[model samples]
Target: MAVDLENPSNYLTTRVRQAVNWGRKYSLWPLPFGVACCAIEFMSTVSSYNDISRFGAELVRFSPRQSDLMIIAGTISYKQAPILKTIYAQMAEPRWVIAMGACASSGGFYNNYSTLQGADRVIPVDMYVAGCPPTPENLLYALTQIQERVEREGLVPAAVRHAGRVQV
Candidate 1:
């Protein structure tokens, strides 16, 4: 089963899983759930300077139905938790979530009764970008990490995949 490295046919001999993962990794349409200060940073990430479009996530769809990635980029107050859950539930299957910023990831300095502590309390998060308000570059780096995860693991629904894990 020795294969020639220089052969052109070898280039096309990718497995079905790899092919599917490749397509899913690049076509992630993000649903930016911006709610607070971190929202501003998320906006900057998509702006011309950061240009998230370069990674195939330029189409920031507001409607959950049209998106596959949910970027929760701010604080999630108790009142807003239900709304966030509703939106996450509405997103199409094979959806992924990113907790973008300290606020969204763990309530940041707003460790009060109103804030939910973390976006993961409402929906499963696949990637978490840290910082009170993470820079656009940080957001971009997180996106690339997510891309790498998708490429390696394929698009399995987080709930189904992590059902065995204990929720903390």
Candidate 2:
């Protein structure tokens, strides 16, 4: 049903599903997997100037078990892929990943035997922020997109999410 903005009662009639979605969308906890230059921008995104807290993601958790969002902001070498997978596995259900920057998204210029072609090769990615080192605004925008996805899809079981990466 459509809500009538002119009527105050419409606000009170909000659906529980929408309310739950709103709560989950705003209260996202992120795991910062910063490994290179893009990590600098990731740090700046959380600084007072950028204020990632405004979106309720101010509390950055280093533990994978505590965070639902993982921001992979740098290159992922083959040696590190297993570690990243382990971290992703440790995270609670309904986890999400953001490949922040060209390096994290496609191994950037380090397309050699050491670096993985992309984070997707190791773990499932929910979003990809393009650029050598994306700006804070870009990261924020990616967060917003994640929020939107959560709002639309709501929370689902880990088995149902299907990131497509089989954990060996």
Candidate 3:
């Protein structure tokens, strides 16, 4: 016997997942970790003109414990790397890291011996915003991308720990 019945339950489940994803995409709280020049642009994104609040991410918390997304917005020097790592450590599970601006992405112009060369070397970056100092609009775009990434991952609640010396 051959059965030709369509499964309506499968379709409903798919639609439900899509709707949930859409909602989460619009509500991202980005914790701006601005250190230097590019930080200026990071500030602009949260202001009225760019109005990052429209996307529901205006609650930029300075405390890592209260934030889930970390936006590294400037040059990260060697001295700052440990601090950045500490903050990343403080964030809860399922956190995301966005490297904003060329400086944070690849050390930009300060390719001297002090800069970290890239924030990724210190913390795991989920998105990278290009430009010596990206505009607020660009930052918003990156935020959208971060949202997309979150959706694609299905917002799975889990911790992503970087490999390091094991405490024995």
Question: lDDT at 157 for candidate 3?
Answer: 43
The per-model lDDT (C-alpha) reads: 0.87, 0.90, 0.80
Winner on TM-score between 1 and 2 is: 2
Once superposed on the true structure, which residue ranges of model 3 sit more than 4 Å away at CA? Answer: 1-16, 157-168
Off by over 4 Å in 2: 1-11, 163-168
lDDT of model number 3: 0.80
lDDT score, candidate 3, position 104:
91
Worst 10 residues of 3 by lDDT: 159-168
Candidate 2: worst 10 consecutive residues by lDDT?
159-168
Comparing 1 and 3 by TM-score, which wins?
1
Compared with the true structure, what per-residue lDDT tens digits does model 1 show for residues 41-91? 888888898899999999999999999899998899999988998898898
Candidate 1 stretches with Cα past 4 Å from truth are: 1-11, 164-168
Candidate 1 local lDDT, residue 53: 90
Candidate order by decreasing TM-score = 2, 1, 3
For candidate 2, list the clashing residue pairs, or say none: none
